[model samples]
Target: MNTSASHDPNCIFCKIIAGQIPSKKVCEDEQVYAFHDINPWAPVHFMLVPKAHISSMAQLGQEHAALMGHIMTLAPRLALEQGCNPYPDGGFRVVVNTGAEGGQEVQHLHVHVMGGPRPWAKG
Candidate 1:
């Protein structure tokens, strides 16, 4: 985890990362926080978020490369741990919605890892 990482007081993910908000956490390290989605889109649906307060992908730069990589690397492992099948045939999807136009409801940069048997959709 980067010591310079900052949190936004009003960001839900920030609050969740800080223990200010409660979440059904899947995992957490200094760099990221993984948790079950309040409204799951699949049998396995969770989010991996950076501890930093990045507003969106639009704000990402070279400085975020390592953090982004860390999140990506953790997503599938956590997805499988949450019950997604193994790789090669059984898999998951990693979704990161950027702005409002991209259907991002939250301002934080978080990746959604969703999997399991399909015909899955969020109500």
Candidate 2:
């Protein structure tokens, strides 16, 4: 939808946002795209990705505050909708891998929302 300079043509997440790649979508809006992870580490594992192609968390600025907030706030709701339980005992993990050392495989900025029964093999 947003074919602007903010989008990276080569980025996988961008491709998914642009419908260039197939994804098990959870939800989508003008600012964000949420989808099930191909290799989930938990029973309910999905990602919240901004449509704009920011490379990583290190690149975030004041301009992205609202977007980040929206993502964070949306996580729990989406997590619950995706089968994560309520709260207290039922919770989720929000992960943002910053760079290579941080274990980020994709260059595009995204938030990983993992929840549901644990004892997951990996994350």
Candidate 3:
């Protein structure tokens, strides 16, 4: 959760998780949904969103931390699904953008798993 869905009635990420806005589904559970980013920055850029709309990491508590742990544990697996590898020439990056200053555009809590061969290469 990086932005404030609490105030946005038309938040796209929220609608996607709620099944109101469709997206390229990747991984999902009762707690979260992971999908490819519509506008990708890396070879692999997928977002893992919690089904519960919690706005920002600052609002997170012990319960949310536990859920966050679960999200991290799945990040690597999700990255692999997007073709990320962890070898010398293959690996991935996991990121959680917290606010506008952190480059977050969505308000709902989500994790970004991105990488692949030469994933970190600068073009």
Candidate 4:
């Protein structure tokens, strides 16, 4: 996911990182990008994605483990920033949609940060 979606030339995420596409950015770094999802699944449904453009989990090998850990760590931190665990509450959900059958919309790998439980939380 962090390999440069630009390779596709039509990658929406790459276009976004390149400023060719528009997105409501939540965070950004040299190696990653975070933004609000177009069709959010939850109140805090944001995306933390690597800039490398790695397509799916199956495509990731040894080199990706570090980045994966970083993504996971970043998720909870960002969730807290977004007001997760507010009041006496606690925790949020981070989802990685792996493949087409897994409900991944974009080809780029992205971590879905979800908070403020909704109806979908039940099933």
Candidate 5:
């Protein structure tokens, strides 16, 4: 994590990162934190959040390149570690919801890493 990681006092993800809120943490490093989603959409559903508080994807800028890159690179590794299979056999989906219209409930930026056999709607 950056020595001067930015945080928002009201951000739930920030509290999780600060250890104020407990989470089923799956991965943690210098720049990001990964944990199981409270309400999973798949057999393997986890969230990857940046320690620094970026309101939403709409706010991302070139300055956030490294952090974004780190999150992307870390996702597959954690997904596999959390039970998603490898390439041809199985894979995972990474989703970033920017705003309300995008299905982002939380104001903080987070990437949802989901995999395994997903449930499909009845046709």
Candidate 6:
């Protein structure tokens, strides 16, 4: 719930957002930063992260509702823009790894958007 900080100098995502680290950016705005995963799980694999330094989903509170909704609504558009086929038959998957047990590699909260063809190595 300590969402006051806009960036974390030690957080990798923050560095990517601040341009201190290079990333294959998909899209970015005042609220979120979307970038391609270096080790893609699917043909179209990217992540959408908040500009603010939120450690993980466990830290999210009701105050983050609007931001979370914005991320959800924006996912499809970004997925399509990244070459994921349209919905119904071809769509994307949104994943949020909560903590260490949940498989989050980085401390920064990010929604993994993966889609495109089958035979993907893993999700």
Best model number under lDDT: 6
Kindly report which residue stretches of model 3 are placed more than 4 angstroms away from their true locations once superposed.
Answer: 1-9, 119-123
Native-referenced Cα lDDT, model 4:
0.77
Q: TM-score of each candidate?
A: 0.92, 0.94, 0.83, 0.85, 0.91, 0.95
Task: Decide which is better by TM-score, 1 or 5.
Answer: 1
Model 6 Cα lDDT, one tens digit per residue, 45-103: 99999999999998898988999999999999999999999989898889999888999
Q: How much is 47 displaced in model 4, in angstroms?
A: 0.4
lDDT of 3 at 29: 88
Query: How good is model 4 by TM-score?
Result: 0.85
Residue 117 of model 3 has an lDDT of 52
Candidate 5 residue 23 Cα shift, in angstroms, is 0.2
Q: Candidate 6 regions off by >4 Å?
A: 1-4, 121-123
Q: How far is candidate 2 from the true structure (C-alpha RMSD, Å)?
A: 3.3
Best by TM-score: 6
lDDT string, candidate 4, 1-123, tens digits:
234333556777767877788898888887889998898767777899788877877678787889888888888888888767753566778787778888787888788888875554733
For model 2, residues 18-118, the per-residue Cα lDDT tens digits are 89999999999889999999989999999999998888888888888999999999999999999998999888899999889999999988899999997
- List clash counts for every candidate, in order: 0, 0, 5, 10, 1, 0
Candidate 5 runs further than 4 Å off:
1-5, 120-123
Q: In model 6, how many backbone clashes occur?
A: 0
Error of 1 at 104 (Å): 0.6
Count clashing pairs, candidate 2.
0
Q: How should the candidates be ordered by TM-score, best one leading?
A: 6, 2, 1, 5, 4, 3
lDDT digits (tens) for residues 39-89 of candidate 1? 988899999988888888888888889999888888877888899999878
> Could you tell me which residue pairs clash in candidate 3?
1-109, 1-110, 3-107, 85-90, 85-91
lDDT of 2 at 109: 88
Instruction: Give the Cα error of residue 20 in candidate 1, in Å.
Output: 1.4
- Estimate the overall C-alpha local distance difference test score of candidate 1: 0.87
Error of 2 at 121 (Å): 5.7
